[model samples]
Target chain A: AQSVTQLDSHVSVSEGTPVLLRCNYSSSYSPSLFWYVQHPNKGLQLLLKYTSAATLVKGINGFEAEFKKSETSFHLTKPSAHMSDAAEYFCVVSPIAGKSTFGDGTTLTVKP
Target chain B: EPEVTQTPSHQVTQMGQEVILRCVPISNHLYFYWYRQILGQKVEFLVSFYNNEISEKSEIFDDQFSVERPDGSNFTLKIRSTKLEDSAMYFCASRDGLAGEVGELFFGEGSRLTVL
Candidate 1:
């Protein structure tokens, strides 16, 4: 069984301030972790993924996440938040290619 | 930069009516999946299809739900009878065949089904 948990349901950050969204996962096998962002009326876009290569993964839109095996955590972070960054973000865990378990999304609000 | 495509972006139907959601995955991709998000809820896994067969499915994929890969490219999910609770945003996704790398699934815009 595989599952993901998003610690925060909503996060508010000021423009140019830092952003953080916590996520944790449980999987029987080696897990693949992903962060996806869904802008309103748009498809879910892949922000980053951790396969087993590097602990630190950099994604598009200036976002990054670190895969911590000890903690079973994959937390997303960004140094500076932009207005455009406001959206619903999901944390996903996959035991295999197509089989995935998604976390309740975290809605990020960037205040100007 | 190929993308997944879905039809009938939004559909409203009466309860107990049948609904068929269609999708066209990336040409070279070998894995496909269906997921749904109820209003303000977490995205839930429905089913996964690979090699012309269902590889795995979640408990949410009950007898009322069926998935098919017809004509090689089109993947479809059919709800035999939809309920008010079935109303949600359904997403179709596909990933490549590479087994070594972390499979990155590309998603469609989603089909919003509103069951009345």
Candidate 2:
């Protein structure tokens, strides 16, 4: 079985400040983890993915996430938050053959 | 760049009415999936289709729900009878790769179904 947990339902940050959204997962096999962002009324866009290649993965729009094996965590981070960064982010875990499990999502609210 | 496309961006229907959501996945993609997200809720997997048949489905995909790749370039999800609880944003996604190969999924904007 595979499951994902986004620790924060909502995270508020001021523009130009650091941003962090925590996520954890449990999978039987080596999992493929992904971070997706959805703007209001928009489709889910792939931000980045970790397939046991690099522990630190960089994504578009200045976003990045580090996969911590010991912690079983893949937390998204941005050096500086921008107003356009406000959106809903989802953490997903996909096994080798089955369906992917999605987290409840974290709403990032960037205040200008 | 190629992307998934869905029709009926938003549909409103009365309870018990049938609804068919359509999608055109990226050409050359082999795996397809349907997912839904209720208002302010997490996205949930409904079903996955590969090679013209259902490869896997979640419990939420009951007898009332059916998926079909009736012809080339079109994938459809039919609800024999929709309920108020069925109102949600349905997203269609596709991936191009063999099993065990890690690939990112391409998603459509989603069809918002409102069951009254």
Candidate 3:
């Protein structure tokens, strides 16, 4: 089965600084990857997704990620952090065009 | 921009009591799904439904768990006997049957279940 692993349980970044949340996956086939953000007391919102089409996919709120087949990773990155970006981020993977398999999740804290 | 919707943001029930969580997916969506997160645990897929039948299910979805799309808009998950361990956030999600295509599953705010 396809699965995802988030390297960090939590991450803290200062405003205007770069942010990185690491994620890795194990799949037999080229998988579909996604990043979702959820604030406290709110529903989850999709950040970005990487299908087979693009290696580097851009997402909302200035977040982006690169699907590296050789590295087996799809790490979420941001050039500048904002206070509103503070939320629980989950890395999910799906079998080739299949249902999503979510990771344990990484909580992001942005300090202004 | 139609989205999935879930009912009863929070429900409190006693152990052994049956609880049904309701969901209304996007109007044109064809596939429905149910997932659960046991407070701080990973999100686990419970079951996937399509064409008014179950297409897939996980081991966690045992005999006690059941799903049904009673009418046109309502998708429901029913637990025969609730347990304390069942107290967690149950999320309802849906996809527009674009499997071979490029659409992702949209999730609802989730129904928080608390078994007392």
State the C-alpha lDDT per candidate: 0.93, 0.94, 0.89
Query: Worst lDDT window (10 residues) for model 1 chain A?
Result: A93-102
Tens digits of per-residue lDDT, candidate 3, A1-112, equal 7889999999999999999999999998778888998888777789999989889999999999999999999999999999999989999886533367898999999998
Error of 3 at A57 (Å): 0.6
| lDDT by residue for model 2 (A4-106), tens | 9999999999999999999999988889999999999998999999988989999999999999989999999999999999999999998766588899999
Over the stretch B7-114, how does candidate 1's per-residue lDDT look in tens digits? 999999999999999999999999999999988888888999988999989899999999999899999999999999999999999998886775888999999999
Model 2 regions more than 4 Å off: none
Docking class of 2: high
Q: Model 3, stretches more than 4 Å misplaced?
A: A96-98
lDDT of 2 at A99: 80
Number of the candidate with higher TM-score, 1 or 3: 1
Interface RMSD of each: 1.4, 1.0, 1.9
Say what the interface RMSD of candidate 1 is. 1.4
Over 4 Å off, model 1: none
Best by DockQ: 2
Q: lDDT winner between 1 and 2, please give it.
A: 2
Residue B11 shift from truth in candidate 2, angstroms: 0.5
Instruction: Give candidate 1's chain B TM-score.
Output: 0.98
- List RMSD in Å for every model shown: 1.1, 0.9, 1.3
For model 3 chain A, give the 10-residue run with minimal summed lDDT: A92-101
**lDDT of each residue in A3-65, candidate 1, tens digit only:** 889999999999999999999999988899999999987789999999988999999999999
